[model samples]
Target: MSIWWSIHLRRDAASVPLARRLLLGTMETAGVDPDISYDLSVALSEACANAVEHGGDGDSAEAYRVTAYLDGEKCRIEVADSGPGFRPPSRPLPVRVASVEDEHGRGLFLIQALADHVHIGGKPGLGGTVVSFDKLLKWREDAPLIAV
Candidate 1:
Protein backbone atom coordinates (compact mmCIF):
# COMPACT_ATOMS: atom_id res chain seq x y z
CA MET A 1 0.00 0.00 0.00
CA SER A 2 1.12 3.54 -0.67
CA ILE A 3 2.41 5.49 2.33
CA TRP A 4 0.66 8.78 1.72
CA TRP A 5 -2.26 10.54 0.09
CA SER A 6 -2.31 14.32 0.39
CA ILE A 7 -4.36 17.30 -0.75
CA HIS A 8 -4.49 21.02 -0.19
CA LEU A 9 -7.87 22.70 0.02
CA ARG A 10 -9.45 25.96 1.00
CA ARG A 11 -9.89 26.62 4.64
CA ASP A 12 -13.55 27.42 4.84
CA ALA A 13 -16.71 25.99 6.32
CA ALA A 14 -17.77 24.78 2.90
CA SER A 15 -14.63 22.72 2.58
CA VAL A 16 -15.16 20.84 5.83
CA PRO A 17 -17.70 18.37 4.50
CA LEU A 18 -15.64 17.68 1.41
CA ALA A 19 -12.58 17.02 3.48
CA ARG A 20 -14.50 14.62 5.70
CA ARG A 21 -15.87 12.73 2.76
CA LEU A 22 -12.46 12.44 1.18
CA LEU A 23 -10.92 11.06 4.34
CA LEU A 24 -13.71 8.55 4.77
CA GLY A 25 -13.38 7.37 1.20
CA THR A 26 -9.63 6.99 1.54
CA MET A 27 -9.98 4.91 4.69
CA GLU A 28 -12.58 2.65 3.12
CA THR A 29 -10.36 2.08 0.11
CA ALA A 30 -7.49 1.24 2.44
CA GLY A 31 -9.54 -1.52 4.10
CA VAL A 32 -10.17 0.13 7.44
CA ASP A 33 -12.78 -1.69 9.48
CA PRO A 34 -16.38 -0.62 9.02
CA ASP A 35 -16.94 -0.57 12.76
CA ILE A 36 -14.62 2.37 13.45
CA SER A 37 -15.19 4.20 10.20
CA TYR A 38 -17.67 6.69 11.62
CA ASP A 39 -15.43 7.47 14.54
CA LEU A 40 -12.47 8.11 12.28
CA SER A 41 -14.58 10.25 9.97
CA VAL A 42 -15.92 12.35 12.82
CA ALA A 43 -12.46 12.92 14.25
CA LEU A 44 -11.10 14.06 10.91
CA SER A 45 -14.11 16.32 10.42
CA GLU A 46 -13.62 17.97 13.78
CA ALA A 47 -9.89 18.41 13.21
CA CYS A 48 -10.42 20.00 9.84
CA ALA A 49 -13.17 22.23 11.19
CA ASN A 50 -10.87 23.51 13.90
CA ALA A 51 -8.14 24.32 11.40
CA VAL A 52 -10.61 26.18 9.21
CA GLU A 53 -12.20 28.14 12.04
CA HIS A 54 -9.03 29.17 13.83
CA GLY A 55 -6.57 29.09 10.98
CA GLY A 56 -4.59 31.85 9.28
CA ASP A 57 -5.14 35.62 9.52
CA GLY A 58 -7.08 38.32 7.67
CA ASP A 59 -9.95 37.74 5.26
CA SER A 60 -7.90 35.88 2.72
CA ALA A 61 -8.96 32.25 2.43
CA GLU A 62 -6.12 30.16 3.79
CA ALA A 63 -5.05 26.79 2.51
CA TYR A 64 -5.11 23.72 4.70
CA ARG A 65 -3.65 20.36 3.90
CA VAL A 66 -4.60 16.83 4.90
CA THR A 67 -2.37 13.82 4.53
CA ALA A 68 -3.21 10.18 5.09
CA TYR A 69 -0.76 7.33 5.52
CA LEU A 70 -1.38 3.64 5.74
CA ASP A 71 1.38 1.73 7.53
CA GLY A 72 0.94 -1.94 8.23
CA GLU A 73 -1.91 -2.30 10.75
CA LYS A 74 -2.22 1.44 11.42
CA CYS A 75 -3.48 4.49 9.59
CA ARG A 76 -2.41 8.07 10.20
CA ILE A 77 -4.05 11.33 9.17
CA GLU A 78 -2.50 14.76 9.47
CA VAL A 79 -4.35 18.06 9.20
CA ALA A 80 -2.35 21.29 8.98
CA ASP A 81 -3.06 24.99 8.57
CA SER A 82 -0.95 28.04 7.94
CA GLY A 83 -1.90 29.88 11.06
CA PRO A 84 -0.22 30.98 14.24
CA GLY A 85 -0.71 27.92 16.34
CA PHE A 86 -2.33 28.77 19.60
CA ARG A 87 -1.83 26.89 22.81
CA PRO A 88 -4.51 24.28 23.26
CA PRO A 89 -7.09 25.05 25.94
CA SER A 90 -5.75 24.30 29.38
CA ARG A 91 -8.97 23.14 31.00
CA PRO A 92 -11.05 20.14 30.26
CA LEU A 93 -13.32 20.57 27.27
CA PRO A 94 -16.90 21.55 27.93
CA VAL A 95 -18.85 18.46 26.97
CA ARG A 96 -22.17 20.27 27.44
CA VAL A 97 -23.09 23.90 27.37
CA ALA A 98 -25.54 26.12 29.21
CA SER A 99 -28.47 28.12 27.82
CA VAL A 100 -26.09 30.28 25.84
CA GLU A 101 -23.83 27.58 24.64
CA ASP A 102 -20.61 27.60 22.71
CA GLU A 103 -20.41 25.09 19.92
CA HIS A 104 -16.59 25.05 19.90
CA GLY A 105 -13.92 23.73 22.29
CA ARG A 106 -14.97 20.12 21.97
CA GLY A 107 -13.04 19.24 18.84
CA LEU A 108 -9.67 18.37 20.30
CA PHE A 109 -11.21 16.38 23.11
CA LEU A 110 -13.30 14.38 20.71
CA ILE A 111 -10.35 13.69 18.46
CA GLN A 112 -8.39 12.42 21.42
CA ALA A 113 -11.15 10.03 22.33
CA LEU A 114 -11.55 8.59 18.84
CA ALA A 115 -7.92 8.04 17.85
CA ASP A 116 -5.33 5.61 19.14
CA HIS A 117 -2.68 8.31 19.06
CA VAL A 118 -3.02 12.09 18.63
CA HIS A 119 -0.23 14.59 18.08
CA ILE A 120 -0.09 18.37 17.79
CA GLY A 121 2.96 20.22 16.56
CA GLY A 122 4.32 22.78 14.16
CA LYS A 123 4.18 21.86 10.48
CA PRO A 124 7.32 20.17 9.15
CA GLY A 125 8.14 22.04 5.95
CA LEU A 126 6.31 25.35 6.27
CA GLY A 127 5.51 27.32 9.38
CA GLY A 128 2.10 26.28 10.69
CA THR A 129 0.31 23.93 13.05
CA VAL A 130 -0.33 20.32 12.26
CA VAL A 131 -2.49 17.86 14.07
CA SER A 132 -2.16 14.13 13.50
CA PHE A 133 -4.07 11.09 14.63
CA ASP A 134 -3.42 7.38 14.20
CA LYS A 135 -5.91 4.53 14.18
CA LEU A 136 -4.84 0.94 14.75
CA LEU A 137 -6.60 -1.50 12.52
CA LYS A 138 -8.28 -4.24 14.49
CA TRP A 139 -7.77 -7.47 12.64
CA ARG A 140 -10.38 -10.18 12.97
CA GLU A 141 -9.19 -13.75 13.19
CA ASP A 142 -11.34 -14.75 10.23
CA ALA A 143 -10.48 -11.70 8.14
CA PRO A 144 -9.91 -12.25 4.48
CA LEU A 145 -6.51 -12.02 2.89
CA ILE A 146 -5.03 -8.62 2.11
CA ALA A 147 -3.11 -8.35 -1.13
CA VAL A 148 0.23 -6.64 -0.90
Candidate 2:
Protein backbone atom coordinates (compact mmCIF):
# COMPACT_ATOMS: atom_id res chain seq x y z
CA MET A 1 0.00 0.00 0.00
CA SER A 2 1.08 3.56 -0.69
CA ILE A 3 -0.13 6.97 0.39
CA TRP A 4 0.86 10.55 -0.35
CA TRP A 5 -0.13 14.14 0.31
CA SER A 6 1.15 17.55 -0.66
CA ILE A 7 0.25 21.07 0.41
CA HIS A 8 1.32 24.61 -0.38
CA LEU A 9 1.27 27.09 2.47
CA ARG A 10 2.24 30.67 3.11
CA ARG A 11 5.83 31.10 4.27
CA ASP A 12 5.03 31.90 7.86
CA ALA A 13 5.76 30.48 11.31
CA ALA A 14 2.24 29.12 11.73
CA SER A 15 2.69 26.89 8.72
CA VAL A 16 5.40 24.98 10.51
CA PRO A 17 3.11 23.47 13.12
CA LEU A 18 0.35 22.95 10.61
CA ALA A 19 2.73 20.86 8.52
CA ARG A 20 3.94 18.94 11.57
CA ARG A 21 0.45 18.19 12.83
CA LEU A 22 -0.72 17.00 9.45
CA LEU A 23 2.31 14.73 9.12
CA LEU A 24 1.86 13.44 12.64
CA GLY A 25 -1.78 12.63 12.07
CA THR A 26 -1.03 10.90 8.81
CA MET A 27 1.66 8.76 10.41
CA GLU A 28 -0.52 7.93 13.39
CA THR A 29 -3.38 6.86 11.17
CA ALA A 30 -0.97 4.74 9.16
CA GLY A 31 0.20 2.89 12.31
CA VAL A 32 3.76 4.24 12.26
CA ASP A 33 5.72 3.80 15.48
CA PRO A 34 5.39 6.69 17.86
CA ASP A 35 9.13 7.23 18.20
CA ILE A 36 9.68 7.29 14.48
CA SER A 37 6.74 9.59 14.04
CA TYR A 38 8.13 11.98 16.62
CA ASP A 39 11.55 12.03 15.01
CA LEU A 40 10.12 12.67 11.59
CA SER A 41 7.84 15.38 12.93
CA VAL A 42 10.78 17.22 14.47
CA ALA A 43 12.76 16.98 11.26
CA LEU A 44 9.78 18.19 9.29
CA SER A 45 9.37 21.13 11.65
CA GLU A 46 12.98 22.17 11.18
CA ALA A 47 12.62 21.97 7.42
CA CYS A 48 9.46 24.04 7.47
CA ALA A 49 10.97 26.59 9.79
CA ASN A 50 13.93 27.04 7.50
CA ALA A 51 11.60 27.48 4.57
CA VAL A 52 9.57 30.06 6.42
CA GLU A 53 12.65 31.94 7.52
CA HIS A 54 14.53 31.96 4.21
CA GLY A 55 12.16 30.97 1.42
CA GLY A 56 11.16 34.19 -0.29
CA ASP A 57 12.02 37.75 -1.26
CA GLY A 58 9.34 39.17 1.02
CA ASP A 59 6.77 38.49 -1.63
CA SER A 60 3.42 37.72 0.00
CA ALA A 61 2.44 35.71 -3.04
CA GLU A 62 5.33 33.30 -2.59
CA ALA A 63 4.63 30.06 -0.77
CA TYR A 64 6.39 26.94 0.41
CA ARG A 65 5.39 23.38 -0.31
CA VAL A 66 5.45 20.24 1.80
CA THR A 67 4.94 16.78 0.45
CA ALA A 68 4.79 13.39 2.13
CA TYR A 69 4.89 9.94 0.63
CA LEU A 70 4.37 6.61 2.34
CA ASP A 71 5.36 3.61 0.25
CA GLY A 72 5.71 0.15 1.71
CA GLU A 73 7.96 0.45 4.76
CA LYS A 74 9.34 3.87 4.02
CA CYS A 75 8.18 7.44 4.42
CA ARG A 76 9.62 10.34 2.44
CA ILE A 77 9.03 14.06 2.83
CA GLU A 78 10.00 17.20 0.98
CA VAL A 79 9.90 20.88 1.95
CA ALA A 80 10.52 23.44 -0.75
CA ASP A 81 10.64 27.20 -0.73
CA SER A 82 10.35 29.92 -3.35
CA GLY A 83 13.33 32.02 -2.27
CA PRO A 84 16.69 32.39 -3.90
CA GLY A 85 18.58 29.12 -3.92
CA PHE A 86 21.73 28.74 -1.93
CA ARG A 87 25.02 27.28 -3.02
CA PRO A 88 25.52 23.74 -1.82
CA PRO A 89 28.47 23.22 0.45
CA SER A 90 31.45 21.82 -1.34
CA ARG A 91 31.88 19.15 1.31
CA PRO A 92 29.64 17.08 3.51
CA LEU A 93 28.03 18.95 6.39
CA PRO A 94 29.46 18.46 9.84
CA VAL A 95 27.34 16.40 12.18
CA ARG A 96 28.16 18.50 15.25
CA VAL A 97 28.42 22.14 16.07
CA ALA A 98 31.36 23.82 17.78
CA SER A 99 29.32 25.91 20.17
CA VAL A 100 26.21 25.33 22.21
CA GLU A 101 25.49 29.03 22.51
CA ASP A 102 24.97 29.47 18.81
CA GLU A 103 21.44 30.75 18.37
CA HIS A 104 20.97 29.13 14.98
CA GLY A 105 22.46 26.75 12.34
CA ARG A 106 21.30 23.55 13.97
CA GLY A 107 18.33 22.71 11.79
CA LEU A 108 20.24 20.93 9.05
CA PHE A 109 22.28 19.03 11.61
CA LEU A 110 19.14 17.80 13.33
CA ILE A 111 17.54 16.88 10.04
CA GLN A 112 20.57 14.82 9.02
CA ALA A 113 20.62 13.01 12.33
CA LEU A 114 16.97 12.09 12.28
CA ALA A 115 16.46 11.13 8.66
CA ASP A 116 17.74 7.91 7.11
CA HIS A 117 18.38 9.66 3.79
CA VAL A 118 18.50 13.34 2.93
CA HIS A 119 18.96 15.32 -0.25
CA ILE A 120 19.26 19.08 -0.48
CA GLY A 121 19.27 20.92 -3.77
CA GLY A 122 18.04 23.86 -5.76
CA LYS A 123 14.75 23.72 -7.56
CA PRO A 124 14.84 23.52 -11.34
CA GLY A 125 15.38 26.82 -13.15
CA LEU A 126 17.16 28.10 -10.05
CA GLY A 127 13.83 28.96 -8.56
CA GLY A 128 14.43 27.97 -4.93
CA THR A 129 15.70 25.31 -2.54
CA VAL A 130 14.32 21.95 -1.57
CA VAL A 131 15.06 19.73 1.38
CA SER A 132 13.96 16.14 0.92
CA PHE A 133 14.37 13.28 3.36
CA ASP A 134 13.23 9.71 3.94
CA LYS A 135 13.01 7.37 6.89
CA LEU A 136 12.40 3.65 6.96
CA LEU A 137 9.14 2.96 8.74
CA LYS A 138 9.06 0.54 11.64
CA TRP A 139 5.59 -0.75 12.32
CA ARG A 140 4.59 -3.02 15.18
CA GLU A 141 4.20 -6.65 14.28
CA ASP A 142 0.52 -6.51 15.12
CA ALA A 143 -0.13 -3.58 12.85
CA PRO A 144 -1.79 -4.35 9.58
CA LEU A 145 -0.74 -2.92 6.25
CA ILE A 146 -2.79 0.12 5.33
CA ALA A 147 -4.59 0.36 2.02
CA VAL A 148 -3.38 3.07 -0.31
lDDT of all the models against the reference?
0.76, 0.89
* TM-score of candidate 2 on Cα atoms, chains taken together: 0.91
Model 1: runs farther than 4 Å from truth? 88-100, 124-127, 139-148
- Over the stretch 20-46, how does candidate 2's per-residue lDDT look in tens digits? 999999888888888999999999999
lDDT of residue 109 for candidate 2: 85
Every model's TM-score = 0.80, 0.91
